[model samples]
Target: MSLQVQIMDEIKTAMRAKDTVALEALRAIKSEMLLAATASGSKEELTADDEVKLLQRLVKTRKESARIFTEQNRPDLAEPELAQVAVIEKFLPAQLSEEEVEAVVAKIIAETGASGIASMGKVMGLASAQLGGTAEGKTISAIVKKLLV
Candidate 1:
């Protein structure tokens, strides 16, 4: 099922169950999707890649907010942001582990014969394309740096 359809179903379930946290998260996802679709000046369905990117962005945003709230000693606020993150993340593809990401980065570096940080750009582009949504960009970049250095 498309992510949007799954989200709609989940929204219904959340409403029925009176799960406010999940309902809020699901609504945010729907709103972001709508904004993204219309941002191009025409209504169009998001590609799978685009959908994944959107979901990742949402998750990242919540996580960052939670981090800030925690740093400010406000667990009361952070908890809900984290809860929302969990709800949003259900729609994302399974993420790769750091070790797996490192292995993939090593393979890419070897394949491209890229050495040193100068070639970091080359390795990163290929690795990001190969990893797609499975690995976060920051993780890929860190692994590429470690391997290249």
Candidate 2:
């Protein structure tokens, strides 16, 4: 099944299981996916890649909210955001470890014959396309910078 469909199933399961935290998170994901589909002029269906990107965006947002809440000494609020982050992460591809990301970065650098910071853009474009849902953008960028510099 597609990610959105899986999410919908899980949402139903969560509701039946009385998992408020999971239910809330799944509902928010459904809402975001619907919004993305509508925004893209697609007929209410999110493509796989689009679903991954949307889930990643939601996770990123929740992480930031959790960080801010923690910084403000509000663990009560932060916990829910962290829970949502976990839920959203279930839809993302298995994340690449730092070593794996570095290896991919190295391959891209060699493949593109990219040298120094000047070629950073070219390397980033290639690596991001290759890594896509498997890796976080900031992590990929940092690895690319470390390799290129």
Candidate 3:
């Protein structure tokens, strides 16, 4: 099923269950997807890859906000952001563990003969493409730097 259809189904469930956190998160996802679809000169529908990227962006934004709130000693503010993150993340692909990401980075580095920080960009490009939404860019970059250096 399309992500839109899935989100709608989840929205209905959340409303029925009175899960405000999930209902809010799902609405945010729907809003973002609608904006993407209707953006001027954009295609009418997003591809699977586009949808994943959008969802990741939403999760990342909420996480960052929660971190900032925590740093400022505001658990009350941070808690909801984190709860929304949990809700949003249900739509993401299962993330690869750091160890799994490291192993993949190691293999990619070996395959490309990428040595030293000089080849970091090349390795990063390949690793990001290979891992896709399974790993975050920061995690992949850290692993690439560790393997290459």
Candidate 4:
């Protein structure tokens, strides 16, 4: 099933199961999808890649919020945000492990003939495209930097 359709179905299930965290997370996904579809100059429908990017953005936002809440010693607030992260993560592709990411970055560095930190941008551009939804950009960049140096 398409991500949007699958999300809608899950929303129904969450509602029936009275899963507040899942329900809230699913609703947020639905809302983001709607906004993307209707945004000025955007296509009426989102591609699968677009959906993955959207989900990643949502997860990243939640993670950052959770981090901030934790820093402030607000476990009560952070808990739901982290719960939402877990729920949203179900839709994302299985993330690459750090080792796996490092391997991929190493390969990209070789492919691009990247010499050192000066070629960081070149390596990053290629690595980001190659890894895409499989790994986070920050992780990929860190690996690239380590490999380059």
Q: Rank the candidates by lDDT, best first.
A: 3, 1, 4, 2
Per-residue lDDT of model 3, residues 32-140, tens digit only: 9999999999997899999999999999999999999999999999999999999989899999999999999999988988889999999999999999999999999
Query: Which has the better lDDT: candidate 1, or candidate 3?
Result: 3
Q: Against the true structure, what is each candidate's TM-score?
A: 0.97, 0.95, 0.97, 0.97
> On a 0 to 100 scale, what is the lDDT of residue 113 in model 3?
86
**What is the TM-score (0 to 1) of candidate 2?**
0.95
Give one digit per residue, the lDDT tens place, for model 2 in 3-106.
76798899999999999999999999999887887885576666778888888988999999999999999999999999988877887889999999999999
Clashing pairs in 3: none
lDDT of 4 by residue, 1-149 (tens): 89988999999999999999999999999999999999999987999899999999999999999999999999999999999999999999999999999988888777778898999999899888888899999898888888888
Query: Which residue pairs show collisions in model 4?
Result: none
Residue 76, candidate 2: C-alpha displacement in angstroms? 0.6
**What residue runs in model 4 are displaced by over 4 Å at the alpha carbon?**
none
lDDT of each: 0.93, 0.90, 0.95, 0.93
Candidate 1's C-alpha runs over 4 A off are none
C-alpha lDDT of candidate 4 relative to the true structure: 0.93
